[model samples]
Target: MSGSFSTPTLSTEKTFTFYSQEQGNAYAQARPDYHPTLYQTIIDHHLDSNGQLETILDVGCGPGNVVRALSSHFNYAIGLDPSEGMLTTARSLGGTTSASGLIRYEVSTAEDLGTTLPQPILDESVDLITAANAAHWFDMSLFWASAARVLKPGGSVALWTSGRNRIHSSVPNAAAMQSALDEIEERHLRPFFEPGNLLTRSRYVDLPLPWALEQPIPEFDESAFFRKDWDVAEDFFAFQPEVNMDVFEKITSTASPVTRWREAHPDAVGTEKDVVRMLRRVIERHLHEAGVEKGKEKVKGAIHGVILIVKKKI
Candidate 1:
């Protein structure tokens, strides 16, 4: 008999999808891009394992960044997200393939795959599927089932997300600075974090694999599953080594918990009392205490990133 367990239900998948168009645009602008090495690693693995580059589907593709980045390598690329607001921003920053192929941006949740589209994605047509910083919100059971339905025999799935943000080692009193940052999350943001957030926080260690399901999907090769991690010291996620408090404020505000906090305290949205604003001021004081001059507090930040790739057996 097989035991049964469900992946943690991420609220954002249903009740908390992006509330407005403006919010989605802010997210695209504020978040950092993944390092080239991260993409290169996925590309190399796909090609090495005889995966085709004809078509790629990026699920949970907020603002279309991952699909946009990978479009140049494939003839056809489509990005799907449950949030129409996010898909709106994604289309605005349009991308094309190496052969100048257009990228399709669709408003469909990962669980639905592209089956609901007017031109529904044909079964066994996708060559590669990717989810970047967005997989944590997926219903993995539906995700893997639909993924297996759409992927070609030799296709692969690549999923990646960052762990908690960390103060770069070079920052003065970095240990204390790190502690200060942790305190903000502990005292304030903790209340707003949804269950899915923990998946990313833990670097997806507990994210279920196809074979881990109660009724395993036979298409994926359990033997071909792979995982890789990059520490905070690694230059693999955000390219910038440091960001001043203002930029830090912007980045932090893009987080889901911050958004939720703002929702709960709408009156404080733009003021000093804003959760992220107050957090930034605390960091500023930390910098001053560490002897960093005003307007020169360029603290380093690094995101611990992890990627998992699994191939479909031919």
Candidate 2:
């Protein structure tokens, strides 16, 4: 008889529920682009170990940043996301696909990977599956099951995310600017944080996996349905985000919690009563007092990320 078990009800989906087209566009525009080396490192290592690395699927590919960057390496790249707003911005702003390879965007969630993909996309055909800064929002059980079903014999899965942003500047008031930003998060935005923020803060290290944690999952039986399981977590430090003050502010404005809060209290954000606005003003004022003008100053920020790669048995 078939059995049933409880599934965890954990998600940060609501944080994105309030994503309007404007916010989606802002996210696509203001967010820092991942370093090319991040993709190069993975592609180089995969090519060295495996043979030709072609077709790729980027799950929960909000605004399609990873797809646009990584598509050239593969013959075909597919970006899947549940949000139409995000997909809209992704299509509009992600630019044209290259002549060598192309990217296609789909409106689907990680859980729907099995059925939502085109009929022509044969099972066990995908070469690589990636989730860039998105795995935290996925229902891992469903995602992993679909991944196992769709990936080729030796195909790989790469999941990564980053968080804990900070500001750095050459000016003397940099500490005050950093402090103001920290207060905006801890003091103002803390109450608005969705449960998903916890997962992001932890860099998804404690995320669920089907394989046994204590010992290796046993080899597949005669059924030969399940592939061999192997997984590793790699950390990428020294991921600093350098941008102009304007871009930095734009990035902060794209914060989901802050955006949601502003949506609820529109009057606060536009007027003097707005905490986010106030936070931005405080930083701006501090910068000005430090003899650095807005739009003219450049600041660096911190971003810590981790990649989890799982490979099926050959």
TM-score for all predictions?
Answer: 0.94, 0.79
Tens-digit lDDT track of model 1 for 186-244 = 98889987666877888988787889876788889998888989887465664765788
Q: What global local distance difference test value does model 2 have?
A: 0.65
- The count of residue-pair clashes in candidate 1 stands at 0
**What lDDT would each prediction earn against the true structure?**
0.83, 0.65
What is the TM-score of candidate 2? 0.79
Evaluate model 1: give its lDDT.
Answer: 0.83
All candidates: CA RMSD (Å): 2.3, 6.2
lDDT of 2 by residue, 77-110 (tens): 8888777778888888553333564477876778
**Top of the candidates by lDDT:** 1
Off by over 4 Å in 2: 1-12, 93-101, 117-121, 169-171, 212-245, 288-298
